[model samples]
Target: MDCNYIRGADLSHDSELNQKALAYHADPKPGKIAIRITKPFMTQSDLSLAYSPGVAAPCLEIRKNPDDVYRYTSKGNLVAVISNGTAVLGLGNLGALASKPVMEGKAILFKKFSDLDAYDIEVDETDIERFCDTVAAIAPTFGGINLEDIKAPECFEIERRLVERLDIPVMHDDQHGTAVISLAGIMNGCHITGRSMENLKVVIIGAGAAAISCARIYRFMGVKEIYMSDSKGLIHAGRNDLNPQKREFAASEGMTQKEAFENADVVVGLSAPGSFSLEEIALMAPNPIIFTLANPVPELFPEEVRAVRADAIIATGRSDYPNQVNNVLGFPFIFRGAMDVRAKTINMEMKVAASRALAALTQCEIPPYLEELYGTKLEFGKEYIIPKPFDKRLIVEVSASVAEAAVKSGVARIETFDLEAYRHTLAERLA
Candidate 1:
């Protein structure tokens, strides 16, 4: 099949399917998530204990020691998934209300994957200061704040200011989620291809939140040379139009996206569909790692890349393909670990640990059930570069790794941390 034809076909969303999605959201429930009371409120005595008189005791204790809120309330296990609806997935800006479903979906994922409760807060304000102020003001109610769907430049500032201001763990999953998961795939890809991080020439197409975060994390992973491109082409040293975030990944010389792919060891496509072609993929160094992550349609499809360079290790943001770099693998579990350890912030150490853990999990033997489910043996090679989101091991592996990192980094508030016991706790929670 012609790749362009496939790309074109994928772009058109079926109205019938769209309506089905809408119906799915509407029927039996108006939204994806709802608040559930953990304690009973059936009797008058239960009500008094649940509220007014009985609540005042914990309130008084919490007033004396602020940290007691975690003990007395659901704050420790609760996370707020806040979004402005500015950048709702690949759909672009659809405003705050329209972004509710996606936010609710995030909450569902949090509950399903980690047993953590999340409330989707769609902040209508677009102004950076107001948005940040609003979240900061309401920050104390939850153990962690998950900033979602906020656009870049402003997103950078919002997350930065929030992290500096709030004591609880704050993370923009759009920025770091893709980065962490992609980094895990890259680590495995490098290992399989016999390439080192230091020598790789990484070309990141799109200087948006994900791209910038990936570039930053790659740098943290000891990747020295990174070339970045946006809608205006290459973000190079000579470009005065570059924002501060883009400037961090700017190369010495500006080049077209096609030119930037020359001899590139890794190509990360976070831009629109058809951003890169098969010819460009052919130009990459031998055993290239290509993460054409543009959703619905990638820059170049897997078949097109394989036709050109069979040695290429390919990944995308889609689930129907092999080595899918889904964010579901990262955010839920990362937050689970963070909240468990009461981490102050989702720092670089925690993120690196998560990536390493994910990469390591793929190398271990795949379970017999998983092999039967996929109808093929799963291994740590080209097609199976990272662990599947449904893989139950992720909860134990990634979460524990992140929790351990948080404690070791001194960011964890809790004094005592036991790794094995924590793993068992996670297993029991899942059970």
Candidate 2:
């Protein structure tokens, strides 16, 4: 694949590319994923074992000890990519049926990137309590639940209740996936810019799920002062209409977006396109780290940022650009590790471990084949603040770190863990 052609391919007005994308989805198969039997079903004995008296033995074993389900069935390796379709990528609330493509795409990523089986499940309910109840009721079938594209306020509550109600690891990927991947970039960007987290003044635009989650995670990483804003303007202490989730990130006083950007050490954008101008980018402090990570488009294009402030280290959510803060780099492997150890939940320690693992991978020597494939040199600098999504080392490194953290944090059900053997197991699964 030619990098320039990929970067320059404009699908918005290109009828040919649009048709190709549609045909790619519609042809050969109706969807991007399908189920295949892992065990033999060709003989009479195979049928007996798969569906009849022989299967009853394992069922009885699972009844005697529920943990035996992991030993006798595929439940341990399966994940449910559940979504209410309230917030489908950059498209916004396209409804359950319309969100199928993105959900299926997510399932494909789980299989392709992490060698895990995922089923895309779109639940057609908007009421928060009903949604949470529905997911919790069905949670026992899978090792983990990946909540996707549920809208804010409700998403926060849904995730909280699900995490508390169910023992299996549950995560709202739209919220924490962006946070984890962006935090990795921030870690390396801060390193390159010679700034410490505690001293940095951060500005986050868009107080939706991703924005609020990023603010919280950055604070956990020792960032003290953070300014955030939504479409209604700055989230501040004086705002009477703020929800509890938004209130957690409210600034001291309401400030205009321009005021929020002034002298900031880092600025993160999760809002709409053209939300920030070059003038806003120029207002940041020297050697600023800017992550304008809106999909399809960003707050400010990389070219616009570079033309205004050459000293800034910029990233976006587009693969064509350098430092793409993609969630694909986080969730698949995060869940892989969580399921590998039968983790009770994805805790703060596991999340931080994954982030640090990603940051560390970026600093390692890039493989020559990866450079040739991506048509760029991969070194730790302004352009390479995080690992590429295609880097095969991700499943081995990030997943192992997360699994180790799960064990150390007392969240793993397994009594013993071998880190070296686990890495080889992860590699062989991909192979």
**Which stretches in model 1 have alpha-carbon errors above 4 Å?**
1-10, 13-19
How many clashes does each candidate structure show, in the order listed?
0, 0
TM-scores, in order shown? 0.95, 0.95
**Residue-level lDDT tens digits of model 1 in 1-431:** 00111123355445676678889999986988877879987999999999888889999999999989989999999999999988777667778998899999999999999999999999999999999999999998899999998888788999999999998999999899999999999999999988988888999987788889999999998999898888777787888887788878777774666787889999999877776678888889989999988765677778888999998899999877899999999999999999999999899999999999999999999988788877777878999998988788889999999999999999999989999999999998877
lDDT string, candidate 2, 1-431, tens digits: 00101123233634776689799999988888888989999999999999987999999999999999999998998999999888777656778888899899999999999988999999999999999889988888899999998878788989999999999999999899999999999999989988888998999988889888899899999999998888778888888988887888887775677898899999999887766778888899999999998766677788888999999899999887899999999999999999999999999899999999999999999989799899977789998998999999999999999999999999999978999999999999877
Candidate 2 Cα lDDT to native = 0.88
> Candidate 2: where are CA atoms >4 Å away?
1-17
Compare the candidates by TM-score and give the number of the best one.
2
Residue 176's lDDT in candidate 2? 94
Q: Rate the local accuracy (lDDT) of all candidates.
A: 0.88, 0.88
Inter-residue clash pairs, candidate 2: none
